[model samples]
Target: MSYRSGFITIAGRPNVGKSTLLNALMGQKIAITSPKPQTTRSRITGIINDEAYQMIFVDTPGMHEGKHLLGKTIDKLAVNSIQGVDVVLFVTDRHLGKSETKILNYFKAISTPVILVINKIDLLKSKIQTDEIILSYINAYPFKEVVPISAASVTNLDHLKEAIYKYLPEGPQYYPEEMVTDQTDNTLMAEIIREKILYHAQEEVPHSVAVVIESITPNEEYNTVDVTAIIIVERSTQKQILIGSKGEKIKKIGTAARRDINKTLDTKIHLSLWIKVKKDWRNNPNELKRYGYQDE
Candidate 1:
């Protein structure tokens, strides 16, 4: 059989399990996911290598109406990512809604093949319900294929892979077999820290936070790494929420983040987290750029 390779973009509305589907397809977590909307603010690439094909999947920020400069920039990133990809995976958890319709409109202008992936089927009650959801989307647009699967449960994903492989062209491998993602170590570590905050912080605090790794120094004497990270928030009130009473909340977040860092990076390390208030940094273009949210 001939070898096949191509790029696929996972596009969807906020909190529709696009990131989860990407992680499941890659068989590992390269993107951070949370119950909160807009948890992903950038494009994350996950690569899958097999004997017959190489699939490069781009997990993009959820497309939505923007309330700030940062939101608007990331929304543009999601829309722009669909262009030039070999296949587009349109993910949704429910019937056709306003957000899904808006994304479908963008498909009308592109020639790229799109597969409607109805994720979170594990939450549904019956097969009839799943078919109803699929009919709603297929009626709105002619998708290349319709797949129903639960990303969290890893159900029916092999079928989805076969469908995606059908569309790829016979080509050489774009990346080495060992590489699974394009994200650097610093970016991955920073995102892992932010994920902990999203799980622990409440209300608007999670959305207002940005994490930056200042320094990562190896301590050869102790065979460990010492790392410093700065967490940026828009207001002092948000910082207080993260810190909690007697510094308990921040401590919990740091501990959880450190644990994951050790497992993901395969190194023992010390992590120090500092919270700083930047006062509406999301609206400031300079601040957005400094926090790694700028347009490429």
Candidate 2:
């Protein structure tokens, strides 16, 4: 029996359901998802290991054209993830907008085996139009394979998985079936808190908020865990919004995040969250380095 394992990257524009698609494929929430653009700032790994093959899928932040320090740094991270993947699943939306062309142009310079995934087919009122959208991409370039799938729904993922494996070079399994993600517990916990922030906060706040776990101490005697985190924001106005009137907003964010943390850890959690303001940290090189977004 031959086993195949290789890297596959899900790269596309923000809010294009890239992370959601990876979660669906892995059948677990290895990556966070929200309605906001760039919810995933890091390259999250979602592993799908089967008996015959183990497929490692990387979900990267949306590729946007921005030159701001933060934007450029994030863009660099996204582009760097493209290298050395066995197959690059260039995801696109059926709801092609003014920026769709720009998204397509990203692949024009790539040399990897590009498999165009036209996601969000569930939203299409007419399935017959799938051909035209597929053709639009196919006409642009000779894709290895073009497959349409609804990432949010458990629709056509078997086909997507099959299409992914078809391009993967046959090899041995990279990881055991029990492991699903590469993110550590600390990073995953921070992401869970950040996910809650994105869910409850306003549009701009999601992008500005960063959760860092200062310390995590488990206590068996008290049957609870102690966690301290600092939620950093870019501006004072955002800080005010995050704190809310007498800190109701932060309270809500804490409740939502604690429940998830408890579930992830399978224990009672005594989580303490605080907020801080760092003015224009996104553009500050020092802050960017501290935030782990710097190029090494």
Candidate number with greatest lDDT:
1
lDDT tens digits, residue span 175-280, model 1: 9999999998899899999999999998989999999999999999999999999999999989899999999999999999999989887889899999999999
Weakest 10 consecutive residues, lDDT, candidate 2? 95-104
CA RMSD per model (angstroms): 0.9, 1.8
lDDT of 2 by residue, 16-104 (tens): 89999998997767788898888888888989878879899999988887566887888778878878889888888764555666756
List runs of model 1 lying over 4 Å from the truth: none
Strongest candidate by TM-score:
1
For model 2, the stretches where C-alpha displacement exceeds 4 angstroms are 95-98
Compute the lDDT of residue 17 as modeled in candidate 1: 96
TM-score of each: 0.98, 0.94
Which pairs of residues collide in candidate 1? Answer: none
